[model samples]
Target: MSPPTAPSWSLVPDDLLTEFLSLLPVKSLLRFKC
Candidate 1:
C-alpha cells in the first residue's frame, strides 16, 4: 500500500499549527497568510 502524505494544516491537529507558527518569521507569516 502507498504511504500517506504529510497532513496539511486543515487536516492536522491544533498543536501542529502551533508548532508551525513558532518556526516562521512574523513578516513572512503575515505575507503568506491571512
Candidate 2:
C-alpha cells in the first residue's frame, strides 16, 4: 500500500497567504503565476 500524501499549501487562508506573500520583493512576486 502507498503512504498518504501531504496536504497542499494552496489550502492556506487567503488573508494570511496574501499577508505573507506581501513581505516578499515585488520582483519575486512577479516570478509566480499568481
Candidate 3:
C-alpha cells in the first residue's frame, strides 16, 4: 500500500496564502526558508 501524501498548497487561494504568510513573524518565516 502507498503512504498518504501531504496536502498540496496549490489547493489554497494565492491571496489567502500570501496574507497568512505575511502574518507570520520573521523568525518563523526564516525557519521555513531553509
Which tens-of-lDDT digit does each residue in 1-34 have in candidate 1? 6755764655878898887777678768788897
Best prediction by TM-score: 3
Query: What alpha-carbon RMSD in Å does predicted model 1 have with respect to the real structure?
Result: 7.1
Error of 1 at 5 (Å): 20
lDDT of 3 by residue, 1-34 (tens): 6754745776789999998888777769789998
Clashes of each: 0, 0, 0
For each candidate, what is the lDDT? 0.75, 0.72, 0.79
**Which numbered prediction scores highest in lDDT against the true structure?**
3
- Judge candidate 3 at residue 13 and give its lDDT: 91
> What is the model-wide C-alpha lDDT for candidate 1?
0.75
Taking every candidate in turn, the Cα RMSD to the unseen true structure, in Å, is 7.1, 7.4, 7.4
Clashing pairs for model 1 are none
